[model samples]
Target: MKAKVFKYKSDGNTVVASYMELEPYAKNVYLSLSRKNEDGNEDDDCFHVVCRIENVYFSSGQYSRRFLKGEDCREEAATYCRNWIADTLQSAERGAFVNLISVRVFEALGLDTTSLVQAREEYKRIQEQKRREQKEKEAEERRVQEEQHQWLLNEQKRKFLDGERITGEMFLEITGRDGFDIHIRTKGTFNRHVRGIDRNGTVSFRKIKGCRTPDFTGCHKAVSAYLAFITEKEGK
Candidate 1:
């Protein structure tokens, strides 16, 4: 697999200038270069190259090797690190376990592994923040929908209380009826039925059928207005 290179800033004197991951099994193998001297002084003309596979230093307890400031010197150190990663991958393929690490070994070396730990914690925090934001957004949308439904119910009830002329459909909505149907007869008569189910599963049916009154009267005007409203609503 192709290697992925990255960098990390640490609290120690050295900064991880270059980091690489070659393969899944070889992910524990780390390589980095720092530009600080042994006495914690910044040295522009020197680079400290360190290579390790999970606490076992390839340089045998010497954490790093010094390289002078030059393109040739930098490339030489990078080539060695890449070769070391390739060797580690071959070793893993031969049934070598590369995923295990010993805390005691790490403590003995006094290696600073805080950069990787902090990176994982930062990623987890970001994911949790996104989850919280999504939940809040969904809750706000439900609240707005409930408010709109309540406003519509109040408006329909006000029209009924104020003695205003309302369609049969409006009456059904205001009373929370589940369904309704209207049938107009040929002799200028009509049948209107409103149906609903109560909390105890009891069916309630209201039928106002065959009213042979004038078109301007109570039930007649309401049914006529409901038919007109439905025709306009359906574009029929």
Candidate 2:
């Protein structure tokens, strides 16, 4: 594809350029050239950029010297003609715009095409940067979700251990209810502790859940001391 740059008289301020491509197998692009001044009148010696800016034009069989208007460029637009415009590759060679208008005036237009390598390189760099940013965003989201899920699992584990110990404690308390009337019995007739194996290597712990129902509101340290006493004195 090839691109050209010029100012169109229809819209003077905007820099107008188009890309064009001529398919080798099909009809070649048609064009006609003319010269004119700023007053919209035909002249032989007008500004080259303004005078001969018409890139493509058509005729019945052979193109006469008649300079077609801008809108008449699409004499017979072809599929291959779409890629033959300026802006196809984002830029053209220096002075290419000036020569492009003259190129289409030929009958069998066999012209070399150009691609803007500089624009392609810049576009690739921008795509890589966007990919990096997207990866970082997804990683942060996954990390936050994992942390919250782990916290919930640990909380559930703590609750489960607490409830098991409290259940055992309540059972022991109820069994000793009827023996409250006995007096002056033995040295260690009733031991109210149980031992359980854990990753901390038989560490002492207290019942947590169901503590209020059994009226067993021992502080953490006091309950730990009770577990130590039971394991030592009761030989468990």
Candidate 3:
């Protein structure tokens, strides 16, 4: 079942060119949202009548598709378009239908109206290059910060386990992403972002506080968990 296609000119008349149709898809294919027949063994997703405007040789524009047996969507579509045609014809005669999105205005607006699309392509390339540079810079900064902060966490863990004092070198190793390492350690590491300490004295752990419950329970185990986790990792 194809969709009912209608064309309306400046004259108050409509011509049926073609129509929308709904048909079943293959096993591998899924049905569209507004479909008549569902897909797969589950039968949830169904098929739909997708209508597209096609250009003929000289006359231009027709619509086509396969027909499904269930509903008369084409008739519904035709009815929907009928009102639009009536109003559009009235508007066109009064010349109240100026198109701001036309290529004429697009060209005037200094947008890329070139048939070659050279300017648009160049702009796209420049944007892509800029994105790549930004990503690389971000990644490089991330690497440096990770190395430094990991070092700080390691030192913290070292002090915690060895029962020693937090030292200055630990602070120097951790710096990046808006001093994230600092804020976290200050918060008291016990969260998801912080974990893992390398033997070379690189450490990372979230300085998460305890949960809100009776006795401020399940808190203050940040260092203990880190130590246990490190010990477990070392054993493995």
Candidate 4:
């Protein structure tokens, strides 16, 4: 037995269906449906259905090819395809045509659509899980950045307190700056840029509010007191 191929076209000429032959004596048929794109060109998407004559009769084979013998095989296959297009894909709505045909093919094969439904649910579940994972990863990164920033702040404060041992010359030389003013005003309070409390471009200093002695060394005590105040306030 030689295989045969048949093609069907819609009345609007936008869609085409093909009934392709399988192996000779296999008693199986392959149906392919395709539609043209907006520019009237055939798109790459194609939907397919495959079943054997015997299986069709055992299933929903009301118009099954089981009755067709010998020379009527090709004609029977074409007739079945026509009825399928008329009853199953009635509207010729190109967008949903593939989905419609899939339902019909499954019905014709007497197969339940539960697997398809479960597959879709599983896909959604996987996508949602991925979204949660991504969110958690972003949150973890933010926490790590915050921790690093806090650590840097604490380190800067610690060095500022250690500035008590630094001489004024050493401070100026190490900072690599010129024209820095360190002066004591009326009540012996010294106003000076605090060492190690550096902002990228802004000047930072500690005001020795209660100092009655004009000494730059008292600046470290003021910075330490400020640090303690900040820590206590933050905890509260």
Top candidate (lDDT): 1
Q: In what order do the candidates fall by lDDT, top score first?
A: 1, 4, 3, 2
On TM-score, who's better, 1 or 3? Answer: 3
Tens digit per residue, CA lDDT, model 4, 53-146: 3334211111222233337665665565546534433323322223323443446566665444444455567778999999999999999998
**Across residues 1-236, which tens digit of lDDT does each residue of candidate 3 receive?**
33332333335244333344424332111123332333343243333323222321011122223432236745554443334324433444453432322223234334444432343455457778999999999999999998886776866656645655343334324222213233345334323333443323345444448943222112233334444555776799
Q: What is the C-alpha RMSD of each candidate to the true structure, in Å?
A: 19.1, 22.1, 16.0, 17.8
Clashing residue pairs in candidate 4 are none
Question: Model 2, 14-127: lDDT tens per residue?
Answer: 333443221222244433232434565453322211212145332222222233333444443333354444433334443222232323322224444433333444555677
Q: Give lDDT tens digits, candidate 1, residues 32-145.
A: 333346676444323223444444433211123332343475455456555654554444445343322222223335644343344445555777898999999999999999
Please report, in order, the local distance difference test score of every candidate based on alpha carbons.
0.42, 0.36, 0.39, 0.41
Clashes of each: 0, 12, 24, 0
* Clashing residue pairs for model 1: none
CA shift of 39, model 4, Å: 17
Score candidate 1 by lDDT.
Answer: 0.42
CA lDDT of 22 in candidate 3?
Answer: 29
lDDT winner between candidates 1 and 2: 1
